[model samples]
Target: MKNNNSICFISFFFLFMFMLMNMVFMLYFLMNNMILVLEWEIISFNSMNIVFSILIDWMSLVFMMFVSLISSSVIFYSKSYMSSELNLNRFIMLVLLFVFSMMLLIISPNIISIFLGWDGLGLVSYCLVIYYQNIKSYNAGMLTVMSNRIGDVMLLMVIAWTMNYGSWNYVFYTELMKDDFSMEVISGLIILGAMTKSAQIPFSSWLPAAMAAPTPVSALVHSSTLVTAGVYLLIRFNNLLMSTDFILLLLLISGLTMFMAGISANYEYDLKKIIALSTLSQLGLMMSILSMGFKDLAFFHLLTHAMFKALLFMCAGMIIHMMNDNQDIRYMGGMSLYIPVTSLCMNISNLALCGIPFLAGFYSSDLILEMVSMSNMNMLIFFLYYFSTGLTMFYTMRMLMYLMVNEFNLMSVYCLYDEDFVMLKSMIMLLLMSVVSGSFLIWMIFSYPYMIYLPLNLKLMVIYVVIMGGLLGYLMSMMNLYSVNKFIMTYKLSNYLWLMWFMPSLSTYGLNYKFLNLGQNLMKNIDLGWSEFYSGQGMFFILKKYSIIFNIFQMNNFKIYLYSFVLWMLFLVMFMLMMI
Candidate 1:
């Protein structure tokens, strides 16, 4: 017990120190508007250079500060939450490692250190995800690792392509790439890397599937550090991404991802999975705004979302623990009456998630919507952005109603007591920050206020979406979509949307089916059918026959056996001599 307390305190103390330093760095950069770059040549040969470096600017400092703050809180929370586990120290160590990896990712400016951080995150995350040592955890870990490996391979490709610039320090060459025609392939590869990390479009299934991890890991990873890493990478590379047709492609992919995730969240039943889908949706929103050349806006939203989503996940974790590890909202109701504090925090996070007025989520999400509304985008992108926004609110309301308003459906009253102060303590900090982060980030990032002029109805478009989505969500949740006749009638359409257009299956089973079939064919025609016959069966048969023919002359007695062996040796020698 004492040792666990020490681990918790030591981890929190170090994180707090890093957080304070990040604040100082943020202040210094704000005052002077200077970027601090530290570099040393680590390897140089044959005109190739790989530099180890750190970039200390407003972006890195601010992001690192958030990472530290959240990690500190999560470590403190885990001391209580994971107290009974036999491997509590191991869990804390893994959490600390995850935080360190994220810091490495944030401060890295050169491709070498970036890849270092990148691979470290992938490896540590796989370990953390599979920490429970269950089948679900194992499968989730595999999906997470394999999905991220694509990004790692893409980063290697980018590293090779950067050889053209003579250095792997992209911080210096971003401007060059922006205007050079030669940098197109590099740009595409960078986008691919970003997509794989951010879980955009076809790469998104792993985000929701990662819910098999422990809730503290979910709060720390999906909510803040890991999922945002890709978006942050894009922000760093925003200089290179501007004015490219690839931006338009990003707009399309991100918008579709938002729509897809939002719709899927309404149909999702798992408590953590719903929130997981919401994270995917928010990631899409950030990517969409970034694609529109609003890098600061995306970063601001990323930070704010991280705050509330982490809090939200922490609260969900408390509930899941109270509910005996059942994550289905369908089995929960009237929890608000029993756990008022958690319910309040959960609802606040959900409302903020829904973009309610004056909350932390509002400051960034509202601006992004207005700016997107004013931009001269095509109808398709425009529709996707706003419609997905409505879908987001729709799912939020449905989840809220089911969780708080319906009858208490838990199987046992003993399942919950609603008095975990340790868990509540961690959530309270993020709760406060989630309420404050959006406005704080805006003031920090935006030096000049934008003059967003719009007509009355257009300005209130967000409100309209929220209102309509709430009403429809209430009715939709109340209606019996699972009734026998209704389900049969809407089977195909409901199933399609509910399963996220079958993307999980596409990502896992669909591709595996093809590969397995190919392997089966090879086993039949090549291995067992032909190669085995020629290499093993045929050779064994011939050798056995020759051995049998020779065995006919063997003797059972020891002297006879020795004499026969000697005679055979002499006969073979004489035959060789004659042939010669």
Candidate 2:
């Protein structure tokens, strides 16, 4: 127990110190407009050079600061959250390793170094996901690792392709190779890799499945390390991905991902899964705007989202802990009555997620929306943008309703309180950031404010959508058991929405069954039947027949030996005559 406490304390101290140092450097670089690159050549083969490179600039520093802050808070929170667990030290180490990998990824401009960090993030996250020893954790770990392996392979291809440019450092070649076919392939592959990492559309199931990990892991993964790695990579590669067709495709895919996640969150009942889906929805928002060339806006939102999302997860963790590990929203209600402080934190984070006025999410999300409206995009994209925004509010309101307004459905004897000061302290720190980080970031990141010339109705559209979505969510939450169940009447539609449009099924059973069945048939017919008979069992039979014939010769050993001696002497005499 003392050992675990010491490890957590030491980690928190060092991470917090680093966060402070990075923030100072971020401000200094931002003010000076300075970028420092430190490089050391590892090997030179012909024209290709592999160098270990680190980029120190405002962007990297700011991101590192935020990552360190969140990591420190998560570590401190885990001091209480995982207190009773036997392997708290191991958990802390895994989290630290995750942080280290993220840092490596943030500072590298070289694709080779980026891949080192990228692969490290994937490997460490798999360990963290399956930290708990259980079948569900094991399965989730497999899904997470396998999904990320696609990205890893894509990055390896990128490394191979980038060799044509005579260096592994893509930062120098992005503009140079902009019009080249190799650049196009690299851009496409990078986008695919980012898609899997960020849990966009087809690769999204693993995000929710990953909730089987410990809550601290969830907070860190959803916020900074695993998922955001993709967005950060795209931010770095934004220069090369400016092709028209690529942007259009990314816009379509990311928009669909946003819509799918928002709708899925509304239908979800698990507390953690709802938050995880919200993370997915927000990631989609970031990717979509990034595709439209608003990389700065995307990055701004990424940092702010990290703040509140981490706070949100911490609050959720406290609630789940108090609820005796029950994750179902149906079993939780009136939590605000007991754990008011935690509830306040949850509400603040939830509102920030909804992009309520003056919060962390509002700054970036509102700007992204307004920018989309200003663009000459088609009606489909416009509809997806507004409708998805409303869905965000819709699900947020619905979740808050169940958590704060509905009757408490747990056992009567339970005691729930915000007595854990360690957890509360961390939540409070993030809560303050959630409230002010948006405005703070706006001033820091943008040199000039955006000018809007929208008419009245167009400007009010966001407000109208928010109100309508909230009202609908409230009405849905008010439905009684005696009332007609609309979901029961429309089973297929409800199930489709509930199951994330059958994406998880498509990713798992839909994709696996045919291949699994083929393997089974091959094992039975080829491996077990034909190959076994021709190789192992058939060879055994032939060897046994030969052995029996040899045994028969050995049975009459004395007579056979005498005949062999006479034959040998006659053969020797014949050989000698021939030689003469």
Candidate 3:
């Protein structure tokens, strides 16, 4: 809560403080972090018992705590960001509903309960995405909603499949179904669903396009709630997936997704889009690790990434607000010299993102890297992880150079100040957590350290990649190696990566255009053209002709009656003559 916006800020802060306390209670409960399931029959009809259930353990508890924290922080930040807006209450309600759905998803082990939350998330996100009511928002909202609907359908399929096992609660049967052949089919569908929700590979266009939503929505969607839901689902079902070929497919798809996002981010200019891409990359990172059989590691990173990434989005929002809503980094420069506090927050979050020594991102990402280094992986997996890691640094550096080091590029007033205390007050808490959560989690989560042994150069491979990526990014941004004309020489290649391999266009317009054209042809040639005549107009004419023929054939006239009486009398006379 702040001095001016007591109602809005207090509501956010209360939930935040409540979750902070929940974290402490969770810590105390970790002494026996056992799985506990609570269920209640909600309705009974036609011999089917519909139930709602909650899964309580370290995973759900910690995830709920983080979701709560992020949602609260986003709402608090929105208080300042949306101060002049008239429909502020509506925005806050949507955010609360989003958090509630995410919580339902996090806690529910029952398939039906999970689906309820999953569908709620997709529907509410669609509303939030189209909140601006602009053409771009509408288009993006459609893309996002449709993309997620695929996952919803997949979940429904899984729910139906689960019926064969006699219950909607999947946790009860994940281990039992491990060796069952049907498990492969169920898990594959689940992976597909998760991939769509998490923005993996072919389903990735929506995440970046979803930047049409407000920045606070981005903070919640990208960081703690929406995207992570997919990875978390995978983590929960990871045991079932481990024995299936889908697990390897998940791993390969995830690695490529990470690499793809990282490359696209380096070529992007929009600030929120770049952050969204980073989010995509991190999600891929979580999925890859989870697929590789390190679920606890994946989960740890998921939590830590949520803290700093949310902070990073908040910082981006602050910058975009100050710079008259121009999110292009090319139009921003020398910001650190102007608004020092925000710049500091941005730098810290960026550093954390790059896997700096002891910040939040380092703990789990470092462990995952070291674990990957120690594992027996193919060249492709190894290359993808390290390459993705380095590109992360590359884009972060490039963005920093354009925003903070280059000369002032803004066309607005010269005065630069950080008087948005409400925003800063919300961001500073995350700033502290981003610095501390990694180390704290390390101590709390790991009872014993992992035994990672490697050769000297191999151990330092990540550092080398980070250094090379940084140097390359610096050269690309700071040096005059290519003029506009020179850069345009490779326009096709540049645009390919810059446009995320043209995924948005291909996924949105290419698919939609083809289907739409097909529908139009069918409507003209079949529905309204020949088929209409044959089915409707042609059949009407046939019925009309039959009715006229029946009317003429009718025996209602006097001539027809007299002819019938004469025939009957003639037959009787002929019979009497034959007898005589």
Candidate 4:
């Protein structure tokens, strides 16, 4: 126990120190407008230089700072959260490995090195997701890893394609190759990879499924390390992507993903999965804005979102811990009456998520909606952006009502309190950042404020939608058990919404059923039937039958011997005649 505590403290201290260092470096780089690239050539063959390269700039440094801060806090929180686990040391090591991989991904300018980090993130996250060693965790881990594998394959394709340029340092080529057809293809491949990593539309199922991981892992992976890896990669490649029609494809996919996640979150009952869906929705928002060539805004939102989302997960973890691992929101009610501090943190983060005025989320999400209004886009996209935004508020408010306002639904004898200082400390840190990080990032990232020229209705549209969504959320949550069951009346629609439009089923059984059935048929007809008959068992049967028949013939030893002797005598006589 002492050893485990020491390990946790050691890791937390180092990560915190590194976070401060990164913050200082980030400020320096932002002030001076400088980028530092450190390169080491591994090999030179056929004019292609295989080099390991690191890029140090404001963007990477700021991201590193945030990642380090979140990771350190999670580690510290885990000391209490995972204290009963025997292999706590292994968990810490895996988390450290995950953070290291993320750092590698953040700092690398070379795609090869980036791939090393990308693959590490996938593998390590799989380990974390299955940390509980249960069937659900195993299934979720498989889904998470397999979904990420698609992105890995895409990245491998990108690495192979970039070899044509004689160098895998994409930093050197993203701008120069913008007009090249091959580069456009590479950009598409990169988008596909990012989609899987960030959990875009088709790839979005894994994000919610991945909530089977421990809450600390959820806080780290969903917030900064794993899912955001895709968004960060896209941010890096924004120049190449913005130059082509692929941006439009990204735009459409991201918008749909945002809407799907928002709607799914509202229907979800599991607390962690609801939060995971919200993460998915936010990721969609980031990707959507980035597609529209607002990389800075996307990044700003990413950072701010990370702060609050991590805090939200930590608060959820605390609540779950107090609830004795029951994650169902239906059993949670009037939590603020018991664990006021945690409930306060949760509410603040939720409000931030809903883009409440002056909150961290508001700074980025509001700006994004405003920018969307200003841009020249069709009505469909416009509707998606605002509707998804409304859905975000709706789900958040609904969740809050279930957790804070409704009558207490748990057993009367249960113990729920906010006395865990370790957890509280971490949550408070993130809570502070979630409050201030947005405005701070805006000042740091942009040289000039965005000019908004909008009509009165357009300016108030966000407020109107949020208010409407909140009202609907409250009304929905207020429904009584004796009241009519709306889901029963709209069974199909409810099921569709509750199941994330059947995305998980589609990604899993929907995709694998036919192939699995084909494999079963092949095994039966080919390996078990035809191949067994023609080659294996049939050949053995034939050989055994012939051997038995020959044995039976040989059993008549006297007749066999007489026949052989006659044949020999005839042969001898014929040979003598010929010789004569």
Candidate 5:
């Protein structure tokens, strides 16, 4: 094989291993496990040919296909996007490692292996993000590494508890399904780990921080590799997630994340960071759906999101490369005239991302929305979700409008339209698949025997809702009522409204200093309190002034030997008395 910097070899290698791994697991499942074929399992298995896990079923195969597809796209994107970058071989190696870990994560028969894959992906992603080793990249990498490690530690505790009380197979979180005291405590801890990895609510700070990497790395981790590891964990423990306590926590976190991230993305200027926030919203939506017992819908969204998001990121990368690393949409206008193909790919991707009709995003997002609307959450949750979806479309269309529709300021000209054909070709291929695959995937999901409870016919109506949402979003963008609008200073309203959602990020920033000062004050107070109580200039202190009598006497060698002999004699006498 010719060693090219921009080839798809590593991705292809991961895909091959993904297929092989699933095949091996499927054979094992059929050979040993009973074939009851739950309707849901059948639904999951029917989507893709490969099935791997403790029991190779429909769900496993579907996830396997997602990992393979997204990975392949990322690898193809990486080739041309990273052509001129240094350490090309090592980059591919890390990419291979990341894909392998995700594959291993999903296929592992037990929790231990899944966690191993989970941690592996985190490790590889951090390294890949900082491949350039600059200060900003290193800082982002370290932040992500620390957050992920905290989650890993929580997971390790869960595993330990499981092994101590439940079976070590850890295959299904089967132990968590039990009503034992220990299982109850341990299950909560496990969900904590999931929240961290999935970037749920409070743990989501690390995600936006991670956008300092190369665009391709952002595409991979934010889209398919690292952030979604939490979703994988949730599905793997579907049985546990069905429980009321865990479901509530998942719902709370997921809902908050959806609302929070949408607003944050609205405020963001860096193109990659906006995409990163969008991933957070998408993951939150998936997590919320999964918590509502719609695992299939969640997984479907995950698969589709990966396709569109990877395309969007890659398109952004192409444009960024042309514009000399300027990722701000403020400087990006008239790109549609210069790079029509890339612009179209990105436009279609944004449409899909906003769940606009017929594209990949619509099918998945509508399904999740439908499923969520059916849940018992209050009206506030419903409003949050609906508004968040609107925000999703709002920012996405804002990006598209800025890049493809707005007039270019030719004065600050830097780009000369040197598009990489290899990169363009790969993007075009994914663009086609991203548009067509959503419906096919929806069909595959509905075709399964187990999803009888789900109404496949609602897809059309769902598509209609998606279209309405996207149209509203587009009109708002055009009217200059939102971020992209030049005439309307929606800024004043956005400042207040958006801040309601974004206060968490602001508060977190402020709290960092407050917490540090509070800790120092707390320690100082404790020292003073302790000194007053234990070493005060009072009666106790006065007694301590003459406490030498309570201490052991200092003696020369001969006197010390005499003291030791006396202690031995007393011990021997005591032993003899006891024996007598």
Candidate 6:
């Protein structure tokens, strides 16, 4: 009864958000029509061009559709997924907030608007992750907050640099044409920010750790917005991205990241973490496509990846929830026979993930591989893509075989009804799309006789490679060679392989330690040549750090407000004085 009530409440909230989005879209359209109907001679073509440029268009609409689609499915999926949990109203509210922020992120006209939405989404995601208030959820939520802040800081720096050089346009490509600046520096900073958001190398561990959140969080984060923020940034600023030699950076780093993450996924015992790592690896593949000068292909991959990965996570959720919250695959064998629908859907999606032709992953991944093939084929990129494809199959089969095929000692037994109808329905939707649209979309995106750009008939060659790779991995699983490919086994000698080494993870503890140490050791003495701001002794340190503090007119409980007021006053005073 409570479950039914909760669903009704959340469904209402979902309706509210949808109505609001439609209202915004309608208002925008109305305003556009009004302007057109007025026949205003005052509206110059150049002025209209500027206004229209700021409006969200087809590309933004594409992302917006993804946001709405994934969010609605999650809302329905959550009816059963969270049915037994408490604080249900708050969860529903947060879901609304999550959807709102994602929609805002795409439609944002300026960098400021984008970051506002970005931080809002990040904040809501943190709350959702920690909603259960368990230790793992709390820790994971805190880490997400900190890592997202790091990305935010880099973005602020980009904004500052662009404002200085290109007049605060905030239209992404405006800065690309600025010849006075070093393209390398700007592109480097932008890519650095993208890497953090996308969970690229050295930063990849945070994503898998994020599995401590609910399965729905994992689904959305991996599929649509949070991780894709970086890719979206790169795509939006394609001109700037194209300016840097960073294409190689994206290629080599993304390929290596994919290989490393794929290897680590094999070691993951948690079902969600396994898929989480696969998410990271798959994003790396998309990034590899982005780096290969195939922006549209990358976006197509992003679209399909969102569908299939969300399906995988939702299925994983149903399985875990049914097994009474036991997520370890080792403990999950012989259950596939028990949950036929889940097993079938999961198998098909996992096969799609392994790039089985006629499935979603096959077409998009083939485009990426073909791009990699034509571009000065680095043997390493070639081998890594192939090897990752093989491993994708191996681990996916490992998951299927362990859950459905093998006989293992039961860890804990419980009888679960087939996943709720709503959850099952969503999974079915994803499954059908993953299977049918893969080929159709591929043909739509690329020319039919891809033979002109691709030797050996690109589509056929891709199908062949995928089959070969999946078969190799499947055979390897049968032979039990999967253990050797796991990252923990590969990295045993590193000794420092604990999850804390992840930059996002380390940044959490590292900030506390760094600030604490800095607070303890003040600069007492300095060479005169190195310090023009210094007075004798340590007086300079006080002045340097507290200059803004000295000018404050108010001291109160609200530190932030007081600081903002004082800063505003200072700006006002300066302006008035300058006018005189």
What residue runs in model 2 are displaced by over 4 Å at the alpha carbon?
43-50, 482-484, 512-580
lDDT at position 569, candidate 4: 100
What does candidate 6's lDDT look like per residue over 310-359, in tens digits? 88999999888877788887777766767888888888888888887678
lDDT accuracy of residue 303 in candidate 5: 80
Q: How far out, in Å, is residue 407 in model 3?
A: 0.8
Clashes of each: 0, 0, 0, 0, 5, 0
| Overall local distance difference test of candidate 6 | 0.71
Which has the greatest lDDT?
A: 4
Cα lDDT, all candidates: 0.87, 0.91, 0.89, 0.92, 0.73, 0.71
lDDT of 5 by residue, 43-100 (tens): 3455442323354465666667666766766677777777776667777778878878
Instruction: Indicate the worst ten consecutive residues by lDDT in candidate 3.
Output: 1-10
lDDT of 2 at 449: 77
TM-score of each: 0.88, 0.90, 0.89, 0.90, 0.76, 0.77
Clashes of 1: 0
Per-residue lDDT of candidate 4, residues 239-344 (tens digit) = 8888889889999999999999989888888999999999999999999999999999999999999999999999998888887899999999988988899998
The residue ranges of model 4 lying beyond 4 angstroms of the native Cα positions read: 42-49, 481-484, 512-580
Mind giving the per-residue lDDT tens digits that candidate 1 earns over 283-389? 99999999899999998899889889998898898888878888999888888988999999999999999899888899999999999889998899889988988
* Model 6 TM-score (2 dp): 0.77
**Candidate 6: pairs in clash:** none
Which candidate, 1 or 5, has the higher TM-score?
1
Superposition error at 108 for model 2 (Å): 0.9
Candidate 6 displacement at residue 257 in angstroms? 0.9
lDDT score, candidate 1: 0.87
Residue pairs in candidate 5 whose N, alpha carbon or C atoms collide under 3 angstroms: 39-450, 44-58, 44-59, 45-58, 480-485
Which of the two candidates, 4 or 5, achieves a greater lDDT against the reference? 4
The list of candidate 1 runs beyond 4 A from truth reads: 41-50, 480-488, 512-580
Q: In candidate 4, which residue pairs get closer than 3 Å at backbone N, Cα or C atoms, i.e. clash?
A: none
Report lDDT (Cα) of residue 538, candidate 2. Answer: 81
